[model samples]
Every structure is written in structure tokens, then in C-alpha cells.
Target: MALTVSIVQLAISVIAFPIFLLHFLGLWDRTCKKLFPYFMEQVTKSYNREMSAKKQELFSNLQDFAGSSGKVTLMEIGCGTGANFKFYPPGCRITCVDPNPNFEKFLIKSIAENQHLQFERFIVAPGEDMPQIADNSMDVVVCTLVLCSVEQQEKFIKEMYRVLRPGGAFYFMEHVAAEPSSWNFFWQQALKPTWQLMFDGCDLTRETWKALERGSFSKLNLQHLQAPLSWKIIRPHIVGYATK
Candidate 1:
């Protein structure tokens, strides 16, 4: 039985290795975006209703904070299909960056539909490397549910800091590993292999805020919440207003 299990594990790793490698090279975003609608449908169905409500509340709070600052300039990294479009303030200048070229069409459509909102531009680039925008230029940087899938979280945070103007805020919402619990830890470890295979290297056990701190933001305000589950697996979130 042990030998058989070893062989099976080896085979699974062999089959998934190429996909993982491609993910590291930034191919996964394109592939995932192509299938995003289908993925989202399944996720929407499976996600707990209360969890969704909490997320909505989080966005509401973020919007309120952003709105308080008059005519803020915003940059959203990994703005897949502009999921947070409705949360942006009406007169704010917004720039969205995503590697998916297909998102541009959706963005244009969203902009056209929402004539009241101010949109400055859309750039096709990975968050880790955004060359088009100058340093200390943007007033606010927003990232929602994107850190887990990024190839280099540390580098992305640094890039965000580099581009943000002095006193600019970095707002984020991410899913993370649960706290110390036997069952949750076990499940998280067990599922990581399969999850990485299917979900573009998004690990369920990453400490996202640690990576953000490494970026050297001046002020960091963070909030953490857990998923409603028996296990210690809190969807360990941190919503912070970090300064550059």
C-alpha cells in the first residue's frame, strides 16, 4: 500500500509539474481569465452566503474610506474584470492593471455604462512589474483577493510602494491560511498540492500580511477575519491602509 501511494503521488506530481511551471511564468492568469466566468459561477454557488456578505461589507468600508479623500487617484492591481468597479468613487481617477488582455473590453464596457465614474487608463502588465507608471505618482493602490495567486507577493508589494505617492494608502483584501488547528492545518496541507495544481499556485497557507510588511510601507492598519469553520483555518484577512 505504501509503494502504491508513493507511485500515485509521483504520478500526480509529474502530471501537474508543467502546469505549475507555466503558472510561475505568468501563463496561469491568461488561462484562468479565459475560464473566469465558469470558475466564478462555481465559486458563487459554493461560497457561503455570510462570507459573501462580509466581503461586501469590507468593500463598503473601503469605498467609504476612499471617498472621504476628495478626487483620489487609484490603481487596482490584478483588477480581473473590474470586479470592484462599483466600489470606486464617482469622480476618482482609476487605473486598473491586469495581465489579461481580454479584460480591456470588459473595462471599456463598464466605463461606458458607468458614465459618472472617472477612469484614467488600463495597463496590461503584471503587478510585480509595472513599468508604465512613474514612481510616487498614485495616491491610492487597491488590491482585492489577488495576493494569493501572484507569483511574487513580496515584489508586488514593493512595486506598489514604489509607485505610491507619499502618504498614499494601500488597500487590500486577501484570503490566507488558518491559525494553528490540527484539522485545519491537516486539510490545508493536504489540499495544497491539488489546489496549486488547479488554482495557479494559490497556496491556502500563506501569511500575506508578512509579505506586505516587507514592502516597508510607512503606516499599516490591518484587520483580520476568519472563515466560519470548525477548523483553525481563518480566511486570515488583512485590510490595511498602508502608506508608502
Candidate 2:
């Protein structure tokens, strides 16, 4: 199985080289608009939903903010397809943000299905900087499976802290790199080139928890665990909440 995974990754690297070149020429994003979103939905939506549901405690800090605003005000960064909607408490007002404009139609579709929550608006912005959202306003912030793809981890975490209220909580779940000396780390590094090209800037070995600890969060609770996936290439996971 290990040999097979390595061979498959090598083949992918060979195939992705041309796409990587296309990316530099600015033709890749334009060409893969529909293909990327649909493929992402198919690949991650179900797995994300199931993992978030099982580790429901990540959102446990939300109750403290229930009556803070007539309802809990939540901002979800990189909220692709609105996949985490079902896991939120009832009546929460959610504001969605993502860098891709192509996801609006699909996000609207998901919002339509989830009648239990109220959506504030959808903003086309990356997680690193969201000046549109006022500072210290949101009661809670949520981001799942998105840190790996961001351009810079520290800037994104800092932005989350900036938008959060004095007592606001930021919930995060991400798949990270395995141990450096382990066999999986070898594959992660080997696959880095093609993997990032195939999936928009997503690194297989991002130690995001370190950046979170460096942020200005007043309190943080982080846990390391494995995601419920059959493959080890993307299974190392972390879930936690940081209070500002």
C-alpha cells in the first residue's frame, strides 16, 4: 500500500507540472472554475460534515454568546459550500467569506437547504485580510479545513482575532503534517509540489497550531487527532477554539 501511494503521488506530480505552468499564466483558475468547486464539494463536503459532527465540542464555547446579541453572531472564513451549517446551533446569524466568487451559487443553494440559520451576507475575500468586517464585532468565528490553503497562516489568525469581540471565540479544524521522522512525512514532502498545484495552494504539511499559539488569543484549547479518513496523506488533524 505504501508503495502504491508513493507511485500514485509520483504520477500525480508528473501530470500536475503542466497545470502548474498554466497557473503561472493565469489560465488555470479561469479554466477550472466549475471543475474546482464541484470537485472540492465531492471530495471534502461529506468528510468535513461528518468530522465536525463527531467533534461537536469545538463549538461548545458558543453558548456563552447566545444572548450577547439577540442571537450568536458568527463569521465563517473560507466557508465553501456552507458545509458546516448543520453543526451550528439554531438561529445563529452567519456571515460567509471566501476568496472564490464561483462558490456563491452553490453557497446560496446550501443556505436555502439550511433554514434553521440566518445568513448575513457573502463576501468575496481571502482569510488573510478582511477589512470589510469591522474589528471586535463578531461573537464567534469558524474556519474548517481551510488553513492549509491560505497564503500566510499568521496573518489569517491575526485577522480572526481582530474581528472577534472581547470575549469572542474562534473555532478551527485543520489537517496538518505528520511527524518529521515518520514515513508519512516523507510522502507529504514528496507530494508537496503537485499537491499544492492540484489543490489551490494547499500544503500537505502545514503546522498551523504553532501560528495559532503565537496569536493574541487570551485562551486556547487545541487537540491533535486523526481524521476519519482511509488514507494517511491527509489524515493528521487538529480541532480547537481560541478565545480573544
Candidate 3:
């Protein structure tokens, strides 16, 4: 019986080993592109419903801006699967920026549903570098749950600053690091490597709020809160807007 069980385990390992190697060798990018959006679609639906009140209040500011202006121009960094499309105000034109090109199809579908907002363009580039977008041309810049994965929050914030017109607003919602010495923080640190690998480069312990503060926006109105109970590790969050 022991030998039979050992052989079964060995066969399983042999079958799984090559797939793991392929994932490490960059073949996983294709699989991730196909699978992550489907996973995100379900996750975003829960987030939107669970955090409805907060999302509404935060997006109200942008709605006001769009209503006041004849044609408000908005740019969204890391606009994954266009999950925030339903929250945008009417008549606002949006520029979507995302490194994952696979998100384009999902974004188009979302855009079609939210016909109130105009889809100006989609740029396949990281938020840290978007020279194609003219400086001081955007009325609002939106970011949600993106800073945790960005290579440099400072650079990303600087890019937002550069692109926003005078008095433009940056709307952000992000999950950040838990308090030090806490059990959540310890788990975040211990599981960071595996978490990031599984979640497309997301860092569970990023001090994203600090990076936003370092940007010195003309007016910052950020507040700290805990994420939903479902998200145990990456629970600490900051959500609000800043004016450039």
C-alpha cells in the first residue's frame, strides 16, 4: 500500500513539474492574460456591490466635475477590464491605459454598456511612462487598486501630476500595507512572494498612501480604511481624491 501511494505521488509530481517550469519561463503570461480577466470580473462585481457607498461618494466628485465642464477629459491608469466604467459620469471622455493588452476586449464590452462616457483611446503602456498623452490635458485621472502592482508609485503619481491640467483631480482607491506588528502584516510579509507570483505582481505590503502623500498634490483628501473581510492580507486601504 505504501509503495502504491508513493508511485501515485511521483506520477502527479512528474505531470506537474513541466507546467511549473513553463510558468516560470514566461509562458504563464498568456495563461494569466486569459484567466485573470475572468477572475477579476467576478471579483470586481463583489467589490462594486460591497463597496457601493464608498465608490459612490468618491466618484461623486468626478461626476460634479464632469457636470460642470462641457467636456471633461479623464484618464485611467491600470484600467483593468474597465471595472470602473459604470461609475463614471455622463459626457466625460476617457483615456484608458493598461499594460495588459488582453484587457482591451473586456474594456470595449464595458464601454459599450456605459455609453454615457466616451471612449477616446486605449494606450497599451505602463502608468510610469505615457508620453503619448499630452501634459496638462487631462481634467481627471482615475486609479483603483493599481498602485500595489506598479513598479514605482512615485513615478506613477508624478506621471498623473504631469498629465493633469491645473486644478485637475486625481481619484484613487488602493489597498495598502497593514499596520506593523500586526498579525495581518506578518502574514503579508511571509506570503508576499507567492502572493505576488499568483496575482500578477501585486505587492501586499506596499505603502502606497505614503507615495501619494509624497507627491504633494495641491489638495489631498485621503482617508484610511480596512478592506472587506474577504481580503484578509491586503486589507488596509486609502480612498479619495487629490487636486493637481
Candidate 4:
């Protein structure tokens, strides 16, 4: 019986590994967009229900900090689909960077519809390689739920820090590993292989906030919220602002 189970597990892993590699390389985004409308629907639904609230709160707080500072230059790394468009401060000049070249059309169209919005630029580049933007030119840099998918979190954080002027803020919300518990630890260990496969190399067990804290931030205002589940098992979220 144990031998049969082992064979089944091996078979599952063999099937999943290639799919996971495709996801990591971003082939799944184009291939699955049509077949995965339900996936997109769930993403949109989750954004509208859970993520929108968080974005509004974080943006509002960041806006207040920006205060009378006129027309702040805002950079959003990994601004996929421009979903955070509605939450951007009025009169803010925006520049978006994403590794996917296909994201350009959506970003351009979104900006065109909003007359108040002005685009400084859009570059098809990773967060760690934003060469076009000058150093310390941005007032705000926003990253939302993107850290886990980044190949080098440390490099990304350093790039964010390098671009921001002193006193500039980094607003972010990211999913992270849960607190240590027997069941949670077990789930993290067991499900990570499969979870990373489907989710573009996103590891549920990454201590993303701890990594941020260790990075070169001047002021770190961090808060954590657990998702609706066994708190130690699934979807632990950390959201906050860090200053450079």
C-alpha cells in the first residue's frame, strides 16, 4: 500500500514539475488567459473584495504623507494589468515597470481613459533593472503582492531604495509564511512544492517582511494580518509602508 502511494506521489510530481517551470517562465499567463477566465475572475473578485480595501487604505495614507507636495512622481514595479489604477492619487505622474511586454497595451489604454493621469513612462523591465528612471527621482514606489515572485528579493529592495529620495515611501502588501505551528509548518513543507509550481515560483513560506526589515529602509511601519483560515496554514498577509 505504501509503495503504491509512493508511486502515485512520484507520478504527480513528474506531471507538476514541467507545468511549474512553464509558470515560472511566464508562459502560463498567455496560454491560460483564455482557458482560465475563472482564475481571472477569482483574481478580480479577490482584488475587489480584499485587495481593494487594502490598496485604498495604503494609498490614502501615502497620499496624506505626500501632503501638499505637488504632482508626486510615483513608480509601481510589477504593475500587472494596472489593477491599482483607481487608487492612485489625483494629479500624480505615474511610471510603471513590468517584465511582461504584453502589459504595455493595458497600461497605455488605462492611462488614456483617465485624463488626469500622466505617464512618465512604461518600461518592459524587471524591478531590479529599472535603468531609465534616474536615481532618487521618485517620491513614492509601490509594490503590491509581488515580492514572492521576484527572483531576487534583496536586489529588488535595493533597487527600490536606490530610486527613492530620502523620506520617500515604499508602500507594499504581500502574502507571507504563517507563524510556526505544527499543522502550518507541515502544510508549508508539504504544499510548497505544488504551490510554487502553479504560482510562478511564489513560495507561501517566504518571510518577506523579515527580508524587508533587513533591507535598507530608514523607517519601517509594518503590520500583519492573517487570512480567513487556519491562521498558521494559509494566506498570511503583511502590509505596510517603509521609508528610504
Candidate 5:
């Protein structure tokens, strides 16, 4: 029996090795990007409904960044699938940025569907380092459901501040880590490794506020609330704006 079990384990490892290597090389992410937008659409259906009210209130604070054009100049980092496009105020000129070029087509389609907002351009760049966007240039910066997956939390948060002009607003909504003593926190830590690997490196236990607090925003108005996500680990969310 022991010999048979050992042989079976070896066979399973041999079969899984190639797939593991492919994932390590990010071929899996490249392949999955084709379907991820569609998948996200399905997944956020109910989630979007629950959060719509809060989003409306958050976006209502849009300021006219375009002096005479009467348009808000906005930049969205990690603008996946243009999920927040509908929430933007009318006549806003939006520059969308994401590390993945695969998102461009999906964003184009999303922009087509939501004609209220103006599409400026889509740049393929990560949030932590976007040199094409000059320092203190953007009027408003938005990020939603993206903080958990960034490569460096502190660097990315600071980057958001750098690109925003003085007196600009940085709007953010993100699922965050649970309270330290809670049962959810235990599970968040336990499942994090596998979750990070499978979910494109989303860390369930990120204390996102720490980095945000360090960002040196002139005025930060952060609020913590439980979102209506079925996944308990991702239910704790923080949403608000920071003025630079």
C-alpha cells in the first residue's frame, strides 16, 4: 500500500510540474487575460449592485479639473474592464492606465457602452512607475479593487500621490484585511498563499490603510466598512478620498 501511494504521488507531481512552470512564467496570466474581463463581469454583477449607492456618493465629489472645458480630468490606475466608468460624472476626460495591455480592448468596449465619460487614452503601465504621467499633473486619481494585487503596497500608494497635482483628489475603494483577532483573519492568513497564486497575486491580509496613511496626502478621509462580498476574507473594505 505504501509503495502504491508513493508511486501515485510521484506520477501526480510529474504531471503537475509543467503546468506549475507555465504559471510561474505568467503564461497562465496571459492566457487567462482573454477571459478575465468576462469572468469579472459575471463575478461583480451582484457586488456592483450592492456597492452602487456608495460609488455614486463617492463620485459625486468630482471637480472640474479642465479649467474652461467644464470637464473633470481624471486618471484611473489599474482600470480593469473600466468597471468604474459608469460611476464617473458626465463630460469627464479620463486617462486609463493598467499594467496589462490585454485590458485595452475590454476598456474600449466598456467606454463605448458608457458614453457619459470621455476617453482620453489608455496607457500600458503599472501604478508604481508611470513616467509618462508627469508629477503633479492629474487632477483626480481613482483606484478600485486593485490595491490588494499591487507588487509593492507602499510604493504604489506613494506613486498615486506623486502623480496628483496639489489640491487634487485621490479616490479609492479597496477590499482589505480583517481585524487581527477575528476568525476571518486566521483564514485570511491560512488561505493567502494559494489565494495569491490563483487570484493573480491578490493578498487577502493586506493592511492597506498603513500604506495609504504613509502616502502623505494633505487630507485623507478614509472609512472602513464591510462590503457585501460572499467571500468573507474579501468583505472588509475601505473606501474614501484623499486630497493632495
Candidate 6:
């Protein structure tokens, strides 16, 4: 049994080794883009379930401002597969930005299923550079589980600030770095190189909360929570909002 298990693990590693090598060469973005939807369904679903309450609260904040205007204008960065669409209220005019164009079809399908949201536009761009979105044009800026993978997190936050109208809220839910003494922290450091390569540049040890604070939103409210053990390496999470 041990020998069989070893062989199976070896075979799987061998198959995946070339992919990781290519990913490190900066040539894997396309492949990562294509695999994103599958990763959401297979990996993120369980994490979503474990953090459903926090997710609900993060989205629930929109309730206070929903439909206050003719339509609630929302912009989402790294809007992968539109997983957060169901949380938004009906008649929300949404602008989605993602570096990967492959997510367009998946996002469209999600929008169709949600029925509450209106698909405004899909821009094939990263969060760090969004010159097309006018200043103070958005009512809400939504980002969840995305900061972990962005190339320039600070620039991304600044862009969100620039695009949101005065009093608009930025909602976020992200897995952050574990505590220094924890087992997960050790493993996170140990596996970071491979993990980032395999998971589209996601960092397991990012201090995302600090970045949010640095954005200097007018109002900041945040809370930390321990993620379910199934996701230990990236277990610590911060969920809340910052208003500009």
C-alpha cells in the first residue's frame, strides 16, 4: 500500500512539474487563466462554504445602499467566474474587470443565473491599471479573494479609491497570512514558491489588512477570523469595508 501510494504521488508530481516550471518562466498566465474556473469550483467552493457567514456580512453591507439611486453601480476587480454576483441586489449595474478574458463566459453565465444584477461591461484589464473607469464613477467597489494574486496590491487599492464616488464603500474578503508561530505559517513560507506558480501568483503570506488600512479610506471597519483547517496555509482572513 505504501509503495503504491508513493508511485501515485510521484506520477502526479511528474505530470505537474512541467506546468510549474512553465509558470515560473512567466509563460503560465494563459494556462492559469484557463484553469481558474475549474479551481473555483473544485477548491474555492469549500472555502466559500466555510466562510459563508462572513461572506454574507461582507455582501450584506450593500443592503443599506441598494437601490438608493436609480441603480446601484458596482465595479469588481478580478471578478473571477462572478462567484459574488448572487450576493448583490437586483438592478445592480456592474462593471467587471479581470486580467483573464477567459472568465467572460463564466461571468456571463453567473450574471444570467443571478438575475438580480445587470451586466454593464467586462473589461479585459488588471486592477492595477484602470484608466478607462472615470474618477468617482462607482457606487461600490467589490473585491473578494483577489488581492492575494494581484501583481501590485497597493496600486490596485489606489485605483479602487480613485474610481469610487465619495461615500462609496469598498467591500473585501481575503485570506491573509497566518500567525508567525503557527504550523500553517511555516508551511506557507515553505510552499510559497510552488503555490504561487500553481495558483496564478497567489501569496499565502500577504498582510492584506495592512494594505487596506494604508488606502486611508475615510471609514475603516475590519475583523479577523480563522479560516477552516481545510485551508490552513491560507487560513487567516480579514473581511470588512473601507469607505472613501
Best by TM-score: 2
Best by lDDT: 2
Tens-digit per-residue lDDT, 1-244, candidate 2: 5676678777876777788788889998777765677877777665865575655777755767764456899999999888788778889999999998888888899899899999999999999989999998899999988999998889898888899989889998899999888878878887887877778778999999899889988898899987777668888989888888
Q: What TM-score quantifies how close candidate 5 is to the native fold? A: 0.87
Model 3, 70-147: lDDT tens per residue?
A: 777999998988888888888889999999888888899999999998999999999999999999899899999899
Which RMSD does model 3 reach against the true structure? 6.3
TM-scores, in order shown? 0.76, 0.90, 0.88, 0.80, 0.87, 0.88
Q: Quote model 6's TM-score.
A: 0.88
Per-residue lDDT tens digits of candidate 6, residues 67-153?
357678999998888878877877889999998888888888888888878899999999999998999999999988899998788
Question: What TM-score does candidate 3 reach?
Answer: 0.88
Q: Deviation in angstroms for 210 in model 3?
A: 1.0
The segments of candidate 6 whose C-alpha lies over 4 angstroms from its true place after superposition are 1-16, 24-27, 66-70
Per-residue lDDT of 119-180 in model 1, one digit per residue for the tens? 89999999999999999888888887688878889889889899888877888877787664
The root-mean-square deviation over C-alpha atoms between each candidate and the true structure, in angstroms, is 4.8, 3.1, 6.3, 4.4, 5.4, 5.2
Better-scoring candidate (TM-score), 3 or 5? 3
Q: lDDT scores for all predictions?
A: 0.71, 0.85, 0.83, 0.74, 0.82, 0.82
Off by over 4 Å in 2: 1-12, 49-52
**Candidate 5 C-alpha error for residue 143, in Å:** 0.3
Reference-based lDDT, residue 171, model 4: 90
Could you tell me the lDDT of residue 110 within candidate 5? 90
* Candidate 4 whole-model C-alpha lDDT, 0 to 1: 0.74
lDDT of 2 at 192: 83
Worst 10 contiguous positions by lDDT, candidate 1: 41-50
Give the runs in model 4 whose Cα sits over 4 Å from its true position: 1-42, 65-69, 112-115, 182-185, 228-234
